[model samples]
Target: MRVVLVSLLVVSVTCLPQGAPPTVCQTLMPFHGGGISPQGGIPPYSIIPRRQGGRVAITVTSSLGIPFQGFLLQGRTPRREILGEFDQTTTQDGHTIQCGEPADSLTHNNPGEKNSLDVIWTPPDGYEGPIVFNATIAQSYDTFWVGVESPPVDISRRSVINDPSFNIPRQPPTTTPHYARPIAKQSSTEFDPFYSGCAVTKLCFGAPDNCVINKSCKSAVAVTVSGDRYEFELKADNAAWVGVGLSDDDKMGDDSVIECVTRNNRVDAYMSWTSGPPNSYGAARLSNPQLGIQLLNGSVVDGVLYCKIRRDAYTNVNGKVFDLINEKYNLLIASGSSATASSVSFHDLSFLASAQKQSLSDVSALAAASKLLVRLHGCFMLAAWLGTASVGILLARYYRQTWVGNQLCGKDMWFAWHRTFMILTWALTTVAFVLIFVELKAWSAEKNPHAILGTVTTILCFIQPIGAYFRPHPGTSTRPVFNWLHWLIGNSAHIIAIVTLFFAVRLTKAELPDFVDWILVAYVVVHVISHLVLSVLNCTAEKSSERRVTSFPMKDLGASGRNSGYNDRSPDAPFSNVRKGLLAVYILIIIAIVIALIVITALAPIEETWTTLKSTVMDNN
Candidate 1:
């Protein structure tokens, strides 16, 4: 009887399914223990949230339409604590199990393939913190993934907190608040409460200069002073982190930084210090217990990260003291896409500094860093490369023989016009190069090659006129060498300049639209077609019996044009009228393209400009 009982126990153990154990309540990991690693790519499944009445209805569906066999889903807090309860009666193809709390986790009840699963979740009463739905999906016993999360859904509280009349209880200086909830009023017209009383009741700073007033800023910060306590609100759209720094100067190093970072679907406010360039080292978090910074409320909803923090008016960080009432400081606002548990990634999306330092006690609008110099730099470059340089090169290449017997200021018409346009190109490029250096005040920290390429193009352009002045005499043995060198340098500079403009679109400071590339492509197409037509006309002129007037001396002309003259209105001039007509058409097209590009450059971030203009027109009407 003992042997029969032992044999039955062994048989039951071996017959169990090789999947997640039925006791997976806390660790959420599957029981497929063969030392296999989970998949590293994005999971094929996603959790979709829909608000039905006061409760949330969650649906787990395959993002790529690939059916899943098993999954474990739960609602988690920022601290990784389980919250709320899942209704087992309303769950489809799944059953609720307790994970530290009653009915707090949901998992597959059967191994059958399912397209989706639906469950209703009710938040704990009076809980206003954010909740994220995290899941571990299993396509098969061995193929599974862990830690897939959905966008956070914020729970509404019974009372509003951002009202001006609401008062917050002060805590000890050494103790920072962890999860204090402040509910901002939400409406269709004014969805964010942070913008209320900005620049009037509090000092506001943001990018794009006047975006705070226009209500169109992607990132912004506001500070309100009440006696020894300073309340700060940081907000940004489509960002993982947003921060504001207080610096004595406009630069970033050795500054006091207040950061609002979204990690695990919740926003946490922390104090940090900028040590150097972001490429070398990002802002380092301060670990002092006496930092005196408190996070009042924070939430990450629909890709927007919002945080409200409070700090003592007098506080010390890393041996440096900040006196909010007596000290003046520049405000720097920056936002980026990513952050780790300990450090934030580079702020590549937006970085704006105030025009001047101001006291925290002052409640007024603050101006952002001036983009006037940057805009001027872009406009000058467009005028140089697209307008002057293009026209100069065209005249030198194709119209040299077309404007026969014409004299402008004692020089051939083509040569005179070419020299004028080339001079303008040189002047404009030099000024633009200087303007950008003045605006940046140092080397660009961006990883793109726009600065390096622009410098090389300018160097080549500067030498062109100098090289021409020292050209060898006509018909000399070294004249051919000079001619070829000039052609090579000129063409190289022009091509490199156009390519540099393409890189400029990606520059954060330029703020140009992506479709600007299509405009550039159109210019190239038209320019090439014009060149082809001119080349065909030149060939026809060469094959005709009538001799054409050569721009150079007759000896330098090709064998077919050895009989050509250098005087205007020569009876032997071939197709002169047709060449003149084509030149006129080409000039008109070049001017139109250059004007369009220059206007776009001067008014970058064109979407905002259009909106502002449209609003103004409606107001005027």
Candidate 2:
């Protein structure tokens, strides 16, 4: 019994070291099985690239200067396939392992803590694609993180012409001579065939709607169908990567994506999956045994990246088969400036989806999802709060005594204009509120406070008119209560509405420039100055009168002559001309501000629009 127990104790001790497995090249997961989750914070280690002629030297070091116990590193293609061989001569504290290919991956040999590891990697001969070094760092057996990656490395070949007479090498021209010409035959090397059959023999989708014909698209895609084969062409200017996704709906999640990435001065194509938003944890490379996609041609010339790909008509992605011939899908196009071997960054340059699902076999132009409603919503809101509401409040507050004797349609001139402007405010606000809801179709998911504040302002504005309709008569006992409540609600709503407009500048959909904040600030300054000028003028006029007279009108004061410390003034009130001139100036300034804001809101993403306009003007000049 003692001999058997000794053998069992030896076996248990041997198994205890299984936490750091020797065969981690395949799954890349530690065998620490206590149900501990991987760390969710930023990893402390990073991979640095140091490349020479045909080889890349990679160093995995603690970014925070914290030592690590174990690590596994590999050079991978954009599709996350393990590539490149590690040179054993330069590898330290690690050894190469076979991950579907011989010596294609490296892992730590022991569990000892180390500050850094260095290795030299060589790409496959004649391979000119995007490469990145990915690492998994283990601070301890139970505390490790995966998907830490380095920046992409450029390793493309450069074609040069050597002149025998001069014995000097010259790089090839970066722009094609026939770039501005009409589309040529597929067999011709003079021009690109991407825009050849757009909208006539193939279905094309692009931004600006006329980019296919004009050849000025910021991003575009075309699909050509031939029996069981579907060919796709993608193009984007000044982009690190461009992709087209086939989604069941207009949104992004659960979609299959085909990307054309610019790296190493060349373009390469890959298949990826969009599991959620296009963030670090959302997009991932598809690991299908057979991708059924072939890259026919790819190039980057004059800052434009183009690629042509051939894919099976029926392709499986993430266990679902997408049929291009009979079924319809929404085409989502996006481009950005950053990408890794296994994921893409957010689409900050351009992002759009087709207005409706489209069949790949149909040769028709696709329309982009319209932002017309969004623009209109912004215009209506600005006109209501900034234009109508401002004028109405000014007329009710400071101009009530200035337009004393004049009557229109049996109502005082001041009251007549004030009621008309306020009614217009109510109508415009209601319409604007409805239009925004129609555009979004649901509550916004933005993290900003704009949506919440706008909703609250709209609710308060809607309640103001209803409360006024039931207000007591001017001399009634509850008249004072009604006046105070009216003043409180009206001022609160106006202030909140202006504050909400400031937040609108930060909204992604607004796309307004940073200078827009200054415009709002200018409006606030002018508005406050106008109020101060009017208040001072009113005090001067009251003191000049021989008898004490109330500045507020009888209707506003809301009490009998003796009941309240107020009385109505004569029609010939002092400072009438000065007040009229100030009112005119204020109206002009308000109109100018409102028009400027509305124009900016309508032409949002204004930086691009301004650039285009400046280019046009320069060309004309």
Best by TM-score: 1
Going through the candidates in the order shown, the clash numbers are 1, 0
What lDDT does candidate 2 reach at residue 562? 46
- Tens-place lDDT per residue, model 1, 1-621, is 999999876644331233344476556666554344678755656565654334666766653446677788889876788878887666445677777778788877666666666677777768865677888888765688888775456567634322333222322222221232222323221324456566656788876556776677778888978787898888888898999999977766788999998876456778999885434435899986227788765655445677778888887887899888889999999888888888887776777889899998798778776788899999999889988898898887766666556689999788899999999999999999999988777677667899999999999999999999997665556766676777789989999999999999988788788988988888788778977887777677767745544434324432222232322445324666876787788778878887887788787778767777887899999
TM-score of 1: 0.66
Q: On residues 1-621, what C-alpha lDDT tens digit does candidate 2 reach at each position?
A: 999999876653332322234466655665555444677744656565655456665766652356677777888887778888886556436677778778888777666666666667778777776677877788876678877766456654523222122211111223321112111122321123345556766788865444555545668898978787898878887788988999998766788889888765445678888865434224577775228778765655446666678888888888999988889999988777777766667775667778889899888888777778788888888888888888888777777666666788877777788888878888888898998877766666455799999999899899999998898766778878877787778889889999999999877567678998998898889888988888788778778988443445435555533434322435646788888888899889889998998899887766556655776788899
Local distance difference test scores for all models? 0.74, 0.71
The count of residue-pair clashes in candidate 1 stands at 1
- Give per-model CA RMSD: 13.1, 15.1
lDDT of 1 at 307: 72
Candidate 2: where is the Cα deviation over 4 Å?
1-243, 247-312, 315-321, 335-349, 361-365, 547-569, 603-621
- Root mean square deviation (Cα) for candidate 2: 15.1
Give the clashing pairs for model 2.
none
